[model samples]
Target: MMQYRFPENFWWGSASSGPQSEGATLRDGKSATIWDKWFDESPNRFFNQVGPQDTSTFYDHFRSDIQLMKQLNHNTFRTSIAWARLIPNGTGEVNPLAVRFYNDMLDELLANGIEPFINLFHFDMPLCMQEKGGWESREVVDAYADFAETCFRLFGGKVKFWFTFNEPIVPVEGGYLYDFHYPNVVDFRRAATVAYHTMLAHAKAVQRYRALQQEGQIGIVLNLTPSYPRSQHPSDLQASKIADLFFNRSFLDPAVKGEYPAELVELLKQYDQLPHCEAGDAELLAQGKVDLLGVNYYQPRRVKARANAVNPASPFMPEWFFDYYEMPGRKMNPHRGWEIYEKGIYDILINLRDNYGNIPSYISENGMGVEGEEKFLVEGQIQDDYRIKFVSDHLQWLHKGISENCACKGYHLWTFIDNWSWSNAYKNRYGFVQLDLATQKRTIKKSGEWFADVSRNNGF
Candidate 1:
């Protein structure tokens, strides 16, 4: 007796990035991205020495992959254009072969009745730009805007939905605060600078897109991790507020409201960590607000007041303001080691409705990844019942939001296939189709078949 159904013309698909899914990292006049160079510098950093070049070969096999999308009843599919592949030097001459490949891919998707959602940057920066300080440099920001403009002019007519960046905060956290991602450094000031420039680049790109008068919607994808206080205690509440301000509002407010949060700005000034900004930057941001938003929700963040006072002599970081507190008896994703809180998705949508003017948005990524998923294989098909339940539970909440008139549009999974993750490689698979790395074979999982039915019925 399933009753919940998504809105008419609701989008159903999965998301992927060029570096993760496309294997031709260096072919067809493509230049090296940071991932390729990082792998070369430190092979031991990635899992089993797997590199960016080892992917699902989507660059060559996109025709068959689009067919698989039709079979799965996907009315939409999202993928990113590799900046290095499109413009080998990041801001100079364009690559004709890369242009042909992307044009063909977009055309094929449209030909099969699948809408193409294209993102400009997905953590894959060209090595030349990285050498010149990456996002930390305003020059790189300008270069990125040029790259984005090139994309809009080249593909905006065919691709109606455009995203400026995917999970913009991830790079800031990974490369600056943590040492997991490339250019790994432990400098909060540098992280702030990089984050500021990324938003600036997004704004500039939005400005460029508007100037072109392209008939499409442009937005940014943010992984909104709802911060929950441990209790109603004032200290815990304050901690959670600060975490939300630093992690979520830092980019959300600027991208949506075209301004940074006042509290966030004051905190940065207090810590003497405010990033350098040039003249007209604020105006650029204010003029370039997004037309749509893409939200990627996977888990909630639990936080509490700091247990100890910070030493004034130590370097300042966002962690100085609060502490992560793992709640006991919380549901957990065993394979990915992340807490599972399905209500977080609903909370995010409602927050947007009440606080952010109900900006049009969609669930850009929501999925569960399992380690060694092949264990569930039976008769050459994976019975991913857990993933099905996970998606259904989240969709039920999304339907609730839509019913309440939350401007939510669609739900796209984290991935279309088991593509290669940066450091984790293929350890945690989060795809409806199983990709056999050895054979390059694609087999639809049981969840894939069930998802197709849900899509065809527009409900479950």
Candidate 2:
């Protein structure tokens, strides 16, 4: 049998977001987030009319949940601090109750020997800030900076790992282009502006964190979909490279290297879609490079050159330059419909090693989401052998990368327990511990037990 030992002191944990897991949306002076407001306005947008108000009830069950972390042999865990919960209005006075809740939660996790990795934003923008244009307006950017500063000063002692945003592009895609998230608008220029301003906000947060001289490592979590060409043909290769530039490098470059890809800049300029930039914005980005990076890999993008040219009269979009090509014979996750390409993880780590100065990084989020997971329940425990295989395969590749001197540090699964996923709600379950929503109960699945062994033994 092959050994699967990981590096010493590797972080064994899971990743979660406040909006997706924490309930009590209205308790203790918590105000409305964009998700809360959107659900109220259009309940139909979310799956089964479920909203963000009542999730896994983590707000009330955090202590018990930390105990669950200990049961799973987790030494480190990642969860976001809902911006709306802390600064309900997106500015002005901080909520004392919110501060108390987070402090207590942090203390509980630390008390149980689980290192807490806290993220600042996870797409739950305060409703008041959205009314002021959210990421598009500079006013909201300043407000977010103030919010980051407050968090560092308030809870910087207990928390050692901080992330500015989680999958920032998802908002630009969902809200601005795809119309899945709130304030849905399909304007390419608006999407570009939102993307740019989000980077600015992240930079501002990093600047504030550094200014405080916080002991923790601050970073950003990005879902990087490596683009693969359908064939080695020049057109197809160019298409794939362009897709990578847009989806991956757009954020990766700025967050790590304190710069943007020039090719992307030229492409935007060619389309007359470059976002409006301000003085000192470049300086701010340069000064705010992260100390660590969290990579969330789930799928790969296969692209080919557009068969037909897009009409110049139509509004610009990222897909206007390339087309998605579904490769036949590609292995797929039958439950989630995502292509199963484990090599993408190794490729990303290698790219970071060769191009990004070998920055410290980790597998922030990777998992398989199975729909109707209750059917797998065997004697009241989910027999998630498929999840186990999925994780094991990915870990094999991650281990290879570490052997090659990649600065990869840890592996955090997509989540700790089955929690609410934005509009999808509970349609697709991706957790080692199965959650019984009806009883608010958490049960460790077969995969969870296996993972506990993996963590305890430092390998399989």
Candidate 3:
């Protein structure tokens, strides 16, 4: 029954972040991040008033979690280092406790036969740094590079896989364009600035990693949403391309090719929305070319030509170029309300193969988040057969991509154990192992058991 077999040494695990899992935020010399400050200032902004402190407490229970990962047959996992936890001030002396914690955590993972993929930034900016305009300031960019260099010097011996930023555009979208995150600003120009500087910070991190001569791979995690036009009309096709240019190529080009797309630059220039760039930024971006890439695919974006003319007085935004088109009869995840386009995964891989040189890559984060998951629990366990099908269906396409010479090396689910999600809080659970918020209890769901077999067999 093993119809799809992955290549040898395929990465099989999940991804989580410190802000969503680690509970002891204020203790142990860790300074407040934007999450903490935002939650404190406006608790109602979070779902059910759940703050960052309400998590699965991975800080105290990582040992058991690692054991659970072993049981699930995970060969690798990805998590982020909280900047506020590592460097309390984001630029000053490194916290001794933070160093000890990371060292022990990495050593424990390695000892358990699990490879740790460390991501430097996961949208957790230190409060102090945010006061200095967060990613908008060149000073914060320099501080981020210093923080990255400190991490390389301290833990480079243990972690062989390092990522600069996880979905670098989320902060730009959430904080600047949308009102979902902290320091909410509804300005397209500010969002453009944030996106540019974040990539600049990433390039600076990559430059530092290479300069240190560390024996490892450095890359960035991009949540690539493939754009599909509703029709073959020229306007629809152009709309789709513009959406792709604004969302995907904005980060992907600079991260992989070390340069911005010419079309994108020209478009920005036409709109007068280009971010301020320094003299040597072009060279720095070229140096930031990644050795690997982590692709996080959740859903496909459907777009069509704008139905109505935009008001000339309205502020500039990516949406002015296109309108979201909902295709008829598209498959959907009933629980999460996201489209179930399994082929999107393969399309992304083939795009990388044909266009982006087939650089070494992997499915960094993919999973189905279901609300009210406990309703499906039976006999004291969650019978998440839906999740099992979701993974297998995606993997079949992934296997096909690999067979066709795509260089995707591994697959990591969105998470291992259900942890606190930002703003959504525990609204949607996307994990093989379900975590009980009240008692901090973790139980492997049916999908976890199924994944263990798939991982053991290298496929199914």
Candidate 4:
């Protein structure tokens, strides 16, 4: 509290997605998404078997939700449009009801004095698209650009900040390696191809948005995991460098600089598994650097060189290059099991300021997800002291970065309300507001009050 306050124009708010918050998927003639498809196949995968249909029911309560947002002192609100809802078949037909729904929602947000920051894709691909190879096909990239162009034409006037996708790498890890998401496959070649096509799709979307001359800013949100070697040993340092090349630079270099890291390319070439690319793909990527960047930094990667001999029979893994170093006494998220290092947030901003161009950016998604959150509720309000502490600590580092002239604009929580996380369901709550799934009631958490004050005063 001793140092400084953020600038006046900082965009303060929270974020959510259509698939996560807005239930009533079956009612609006909306076809199923990958989540819907997954729940149908394996109900046991989700926590308490809770699926998308049992979400926060924002579809019916959006008007009142906007009023609640005003009470929370939000200057901006981020939400995604469901691709399945936009085009039920994802190509041929447009759902008029879906168009009306989004239009009304955007209008209400504007009327409530909250700027709408819309995201086109948020990891919920339409089930129909997934049935056709999804991002693996070049045709799907064209479809995504078509979808994005349609959104810009429809909501460009009200939505000032547009994000092409949220945490693109999550799918590669979740779907390919971990089997936590739908279409789960543990193939490194497919992972490389998926990663390549996602970046291409992002560039394609941005190019279309600019071509349309829309009255908004288009950017992509990347979850940056900065790498730290466990020790000063040569092998450990080399391991960290390779980890950085694959995890961070693989996308960061292409997104910010429009070219993948040379080391990453060499690694792919070694396997003879590089993704298919056209002659003009590199030029297209270079032409569409984002106007703004949304950074989602949760933690840093602690790495050490592979101490043991590599397993000859083991399946392909990112861990082959390095081992996860468990640093003793590192702070951890009590409920979610993620490490909490407030300095990581500052380090991320400084990296962007130094290595990546000092692009206009902000914390897009960063919050602690706690289990059994209802136990902390007090008299109908959630007394989320832990969440408040988390945000306060992160904000202090953010403020320091700002003081050092890092081009940060503001901080947005991971979410606005407790919503359906893809496979985890209600296992972890990362919302500023507690959502009662059964009753559709929204209660402001203790952290929401802290954020409101930060928004009101422009700082703590």
Candidate 5:
């Protein structure tokens, strides 16, 4: 086998979020977020009733976790600053405890020779801001801008890489369209509004970051699922294109090119789903072009033209023009039930290279989640050979992309440790270090050991 070497100084780490890892949900002056509220209202919605408060307790054990990261030879790590924790009221006096915690955490990471890539939001919207109509209201957008600016002003010096949001589309799909998230509203128009406002917020954050003259780079983390047509037919090709427009280009265009795709705009207009945009919005988005992009690839989207007639009375949706096509013989991740498509990573990079000016990017989040992962535990440590293989497969394609001058700079897995996930909670574990939730013990898995060597060598 050929040695899969990466570029010099290639970043190797993992991505986590405040809402998922930090267990002190309401402690240290943190206000309620949508996660806290939803879990309070319906604990049954979460796996085994495990709420946000029952996470890995990073807030309490960050020192040990940082040590674990050092042991793993991580060069960089990505996590978010909880808006609810930073500003309890959404816009008021900054919480001193939150500031102290983040400052100490960032300094500790720096002292450990690890670079901290900080994100401003990660779907843990402050409940107060959500009450103000979430992303639909321009007021919440302004508040988010303020929160982002606060993050840059407070920690911009220590953190050189900043992201405006992580998977910003998840909220639109989970909250507005799919009913998997809080404020579960199944309305396409509302989903469009949320999506549009999120990009606007992202642009505003970038604008503010540049205005402050921060010596740092700011970008947005998007989970880009490359859309693949089921057949060579024109209808199938058109269907895949539409799906790509709705899910990928909707955010990618504005964040990179500083404008929305013309086809997306026309499609939304045709469906009467055009989001309400304020004056000067175009210029604002134009200013939102990022210096970096974080790409999270796990699966590819297979689609084909809709085979059945549409009901005029039904609410409009992206699917009105396309239908999901599950390709036969596709590789699968049995536990997560998601397609295992390693080549999709290369496809995304190639697309960026050929179409989007080859933006400087990194694989910010990619990992396999296994339900009942404890079944693989052996001799007090998880023999996660499956995970090791999963990562190696993806990195093989990532190396191919980089060799072809894709401009992809690094690779970060989905997580470093087993932590609480939204709704699913800890039902599926995606981590290199397994956390004994019962005793707060951390054990490095086989993959973690393997990754340490890969990071040290900058290859496998």
Candidate 6:
């Protein structure tokens, strides 16, 4: 195998979230979130009929969890603060217990020599706020900015990096388009509105962080899947371009360049679906280019021209141009059915290098998730060679990008332990540490041991 060394001070760690890990939801005076609402309304949508209680009990085992981080040779850890945990109502009273809990978690991570990267939101919107239109309403954006400001004021000195949102499009498409979340709707116009407001909330949060005078970096995380057409036919090329515009540039151009692509804007306008914008939105976004970028590359999108003719009088649809193509021979994660293309990471990095100004960036969430992962059992441990291969292959491309002077600094896998995945529940496990749902016990996998060596050596 080839070898490449990472830069000095490069981050190596695992990422997790509070909603997925903190099971004592009601215990900490934390109110319900959109996830809670969804589960309440329909429990059958979740895999294995699991719910939040199946969350990886990190709220109880965080001290041990941080210890596990040290054993894994990690120098950084990415985690989220549950907004409802801090402000059960999304405004006014602050939960002192929630504050103490987070303070202790941060202290433990730092005490173990792991730098803490905190993100403010990760799709767990407070149910109270969601009832008021969620991100679709300008009021929710203001509330979010307030929430960001409060977190900074409380934890700015201790937190070195803060992120405003994580995988912003997931909510728009999953909830609004695919009916996978609370208040599920399949209207494309509403999806467009949700996307616009989410970006606005991001800008407003950035603006607030600037006002608070924190001496740390803040950014948004986009799950960017580089789009590739199935072939060079003209229609295929056009279809691929539209997919990229919607999935990539919708957030990339605004968050990075502070403006939307002209074609995207025109397309939205022609459909009378452009979001309601404030007078200063342009200036706010322009002045709000992030201090850093978090790239979450899981797979590349393979597209082909539509298989059928278009209706000349029908309303605008992103699908009128392109359809997804399931290419043959691409590696597959049989556990959860997502294509595995390691070079996709390199393509994303190179695009950033040439087109996106080579912004300071790093992989925030990339990992292999497996279903019924425990069955691959060894002598009291899971022998996850597939997971190890996943990281190694992705790192090979990452090493390539770094060798060519791409601005990427580090690699953080999708998770630290098997935690609750929104609709999937505990079905797809992506973790170095395995969480026994019955007892909430933490155990290291064979790959976890291998990762410790990877971190200690700084290369492979």
lDDT tens per residue, model 1, 1-460: 5598788999999999898999989998999988999999999999889999999999989999999999999999999999999999888899999999999999999999999999999999899999999999999999999999999989988999999999999999999998999999888999999999999999999999989998989999999999999999999999999999999999999999999999999999998899998899899989768999999999999999999999887778888989999999999988789888888999999999999999999999999999989999999999999999999999999998889989999999888889999999998999999999999999999999999999999998
Per-residue lDDT of model 6, residues 99-185, tens digit only:
999999999988999999998888899999999999888888888888888899989989989998888999998878777876788
Candidate 2 on 1-460: residue-level lDDT in tens? Answer: 4398888999999999999999998888888988988899999988898888769999999999889999999999999988888988889888999999999999999999999999999999999999999998999999999999999999999999999999999999999998999888999899999999999999999999998997889999999999999999999999999999889999999999998999999999998889999889999999779999999999889999999989888777888879999999999989889999998999999999999999999999999999998999999999999999999999999999999999999999988999999999988999988999889899999999999999999888
For model 6, the local distance difference test gives 0.88
Worst 10 residues of 5 by lDDT: 1-10
Q: Better model by TM-score, 3 or 4?
A: 3
Please, what are the lDDT tens digits per residue for candidate 3 over residues 1-460? Answer: 7799899999999999999888898989999999999999999999899999888898988898999999999999999898899999989899999999999999999999999999999989999999999999999999999999999999999999999999998999999987899888888888999999998899999989999998999999999999999899999999999999999999999998999999999999999988898999998889999999999999999999999999889878899999998889999999989999999999999999999999999999999999999999999899999999999999999999999999999999998999899899999999999999888899999999999999999999
Clashing pairs in 2: none
lDDT at position 12, candidate 5: 98
TM-score of every model versus the real structure: 0.99, 0.99, 0.99, 0.97, 0.99, 0.97
| Model 3 misplacement above 4 A | none
lDDT of 4 by residue, 1-460 (tens): 6355888788889888999989987777899999888899999998899998988888898999888888889988889999999998878678899999999999999998898889999898998998888888788888988998888988888788999988888888888777878788888788888888899999999898899887779888888887899899999999999888878887788888888888889987986668888889998888668888888888889999997988867767778889989888999997888999999999989999998888889998888999999999889888988988999899999999999999999888988888889888888999888888777778888888888888888887
lDDT of each: 0.93, 0.92, 0.94, 0.87, 0.94, 0.88
**Clashing residue pairs found in predicted model 4:** none
lDDT of 5: 0.94
Q: Which residue pairs collide, candidate 1? A: none
- lDDT for residue 90 in candidate 2, whole number 0-100: 85
Alpha-carbon RMSD, candidate 2: 0.9
Task: Give the C-alpha miss distance for residue 205 in model 1, angstroms.
Answer: 0.5
Candidate 6, residue 458: lDDT: 88
Residue 282 lDDT in candidate 6: 88
